[model samples]
Target: MGGLLSILKGGAKEEEPIDIPLNFGAQPSGPEIEYYNAVAGLMRAAPGILNDLRSYSGCGEAIRQAISNPGKATEDAAWAVVCPAVAKLKDYYDFSCALGNAMGAHAGADQQAPVVSPTEQLFPRILSFLGNGDASQNFEQSQALARKLAEILDFATQFDNLKARSASQPAGQPATMSNPNVQNDFSYYRRTVSRMKMNNAQSVAVVSDEVANKMSLFFAHSNPVTKALIDSANVAVMSRTLSLGGATDVFSILAGVSYHMVAKGRAGNDSAFFLRVMVVSVLLYDHIDPAGAFIKNSKINIKASIKVIQSSGGSGADALLNALRFSTQHLNDETTPKAIKQMLAQ
Candidate 1:
């Protein structure tokens, strides 16, 4: 997280830290005006969108079918039943809030503007459309809509957490919930491998060899429990290492260990749930961080960092950072044009 902060800060040169009073009441600028316009467009369409939704065949049919249970009915309905309507509503609220911000700026009430508590927060001035309903009914509808949206947006895909758990266990050995101390298992190997290249682990082969040597040392010992633990960890690590050892393979085998572990159901069963959280933590780190650069004169190579991010589906922060890093490092590459760099920065 600190590394991410450094990278963000690195984009700008150091300057005196000046303490400026923040006036929440300050007026907004042209870009903010455009932002409000976009939001207003969406907001103004809310009532019509909701009306369309209410009359839509699917929504009407779903509602009728759900007569037995409104709660269950909401769960089964498509986004058409709620998304367009609620999204428009949310847009209206956002626009009103933004307008209030713009007004605040005009008043120079930036920091002094009163912060409304959740319960005390009044309905947006534009959402008078919802005022026709009884308070109890309106609240119910809002709650239902919120619940339905939550269901739609829930990223049911189980990737990071599972891999972390699988990695935690020693390679080749199936990790069980009963056995807590699994030694230097797959998880250990994953952490090791991720650290290896980032910190410049001598070579991929060397990292693997080290794991093997450590396993050998563990097995050669007298204690059965210790040997078994080490052996299990070795197996887990080896599986990931082999798959991720290739030059073009950017996916961190170590990171994927968690995914596999979660799939194996070992993640939730763990005593500490450390492995599960670690997987997410790694993702969070990768998400906001810029790909570290190794710039020497004109030569540029984003191969290492870019590959890692691309292998992970290319949506993470590392991917974006890597792109920026590549552009920054090679801005003056002999073959490239300055215009291209300017275009990319835009």
Candidate 2:
């Protein structure tokens, strides 16, 4: 709350703006201009998307307020802000998935000189994988990760806890959790909460009162949303469903349970759908991102969740994994070690 975000806001530094013509990696040729134009249109529309991205700010703000003010009113305000933001974010996420899908189909169609796909645009490094017109020569470090994701998504799609409601045993998924209780208390099974201290909201936000107040300062970088999600997930009594708050990050719970219940799917409804996309997003983020401190020196746990998912695959595993791979194929980030290393690769 105070350190990272505040530093980002308050740290005074002088910088000179480079007046340079920027293009999205396009040469000033024919097709390149076409691509650049598309990118420009996207850039023009970026504000709306950016707004959606920053919409999480509301919850972030509410999180800070809850920590600083500390009261029932503050807690309720946080919940109100967070829930709606999550709902809206899910829709935006769905759109991104659809865009990724279209990107893949198009890229696949062109074998010889593959045209750049939108997926590659978001994650430009993927374009580097096309190889020297030879599949064998391509950069494929992610295949190992992809196959693992495929298994998980495949497992999730087949798992339909609602099927149990219809009759008794659902054939789609005969294999529930070997230890269902693991989902209830992720920490008992997987250890992601070694450092995070929690107070009980005892409500949906999951923790509140004097407990949240006293320790608020220690957790300034994180919002109450994270604490609630982790706490609710740790002791959730869900079945093929998880506490809605866990949508903050499914860790690997979505692998077993398709969606989050409120009050849930392999993506049955919006929340499920959102979580489905989010699971992959977090996993992909973990696969490439480092164990070192993120931009904010933030305390959010990214690696532990994927460690669980990769250890035991999840629903729509193959499809989701494929979509994500295609979506991010062209993506590049110099900030990530993997990408930097790849750029240096011969």
Candidate 3:
């Protein structure tokens, strides 16, 4: 009976099959090589992606350098592998390069690890005003900004979650990392990635100005620009939201007031100084509120403007006045308008 049973079992001992290690050194299969090729593509594309983002912000100097010297930008981009280094610690010389890389990676065709870009913020705000009456384009711009922001925030959240899990992981588990927390984070990342891709795939057509305004406020806080620019963008976004909420001409008046406040009244030598003043003026003028009296407060005009306009030296006050004068000529039309021209002529 034992011999018969052994014959029936065909010499099987009921032993479990041994697992073999995957050898990475062997020349990769087609699919494996393709995957590796994709990764290499990502590595090579990462830097140029960043440069494209930097260009979006209209940072003429940075763009100029990137265009003028590609080698330096490429090196700086490679150095930005570390998350924190990519996020914050960028040298002034290589700041644009780093910023470019982050933007590129965030807004790249492949949504791997999104990051916030100052350019993304500025682009929408600028586009809203300068869209040549193309609401579709404006909406598209807004949607793009939203998608990029979502991706970046998602990346940050996932990175943080992963780092926390990795830190808390028990030692000696090198073969497999199967922590629940890590799994959850991966799930979340997957969802976020899907959402971002969906956003990209869909037509980004914002129906309301509220979305634009929020984006403007976000950029105002993030980018390193003059205080006037921040304040102006905030006001612009606020004006747009208010207009959408039934405020009439509040933005228009605000624009004029903001324009005068910074262009002829403030100080700064920065190239963006004049542009920011002009932007605020345009934004405020577009959406002026009547019922609530959301006009420029007395204190902002008095304390801030007085301090800015009073400087005789070329630092804060003096530079601000110079910017104001330059902007006023263009905004207030010091040349064409007879009354303004006469007043200035006098």
Q: Which candidate, 1 or 3, would have the higher TM-score against the true structure?
A: 3
Q: Tell me the lDDT of model 1 at 313.
A: 26
Q: Give, for candidate 3, the lowest lDDT window spanning 10 residues.
A: 15-24
Q: On residues 174-283, what C-alpha lDDT tens digit does candidate 1 reach at each position?
A: 22221121222322333444655687845333234433443333222222221221222222233332111120011121123233333344435531222322222222
Each prediction's TM-score versus the true structure? 0.15, 0.22, 0.22
Candidate 1: worst-modelled 10 consecutive residues by lDDT: 152-161
- Candidate 2 residues lying further than 4 Å off, grouped into runs, are 1-29, 32-34, 47-79, 91-346
Where model 3 places Cα greater than 4 Å from the true spot, the runs are 1-85, 89-241, 244-283, 286-308, 311-315, 325-346
Error of 1 at 210 (Å): 53
Per-model C-alpha lDDT, please?
0.28, 0.29, 0.29
Global local distance difference test of model 1: 0.28
The residue ranges of model 1 lying beyond 4 angstroms of the native Cα positions read: 1-21, 30-32, 43-346
| Candidate 1 local lDDT, residue 106 | 21
What local lDDT does model 1 show for residue 289?
A: 23
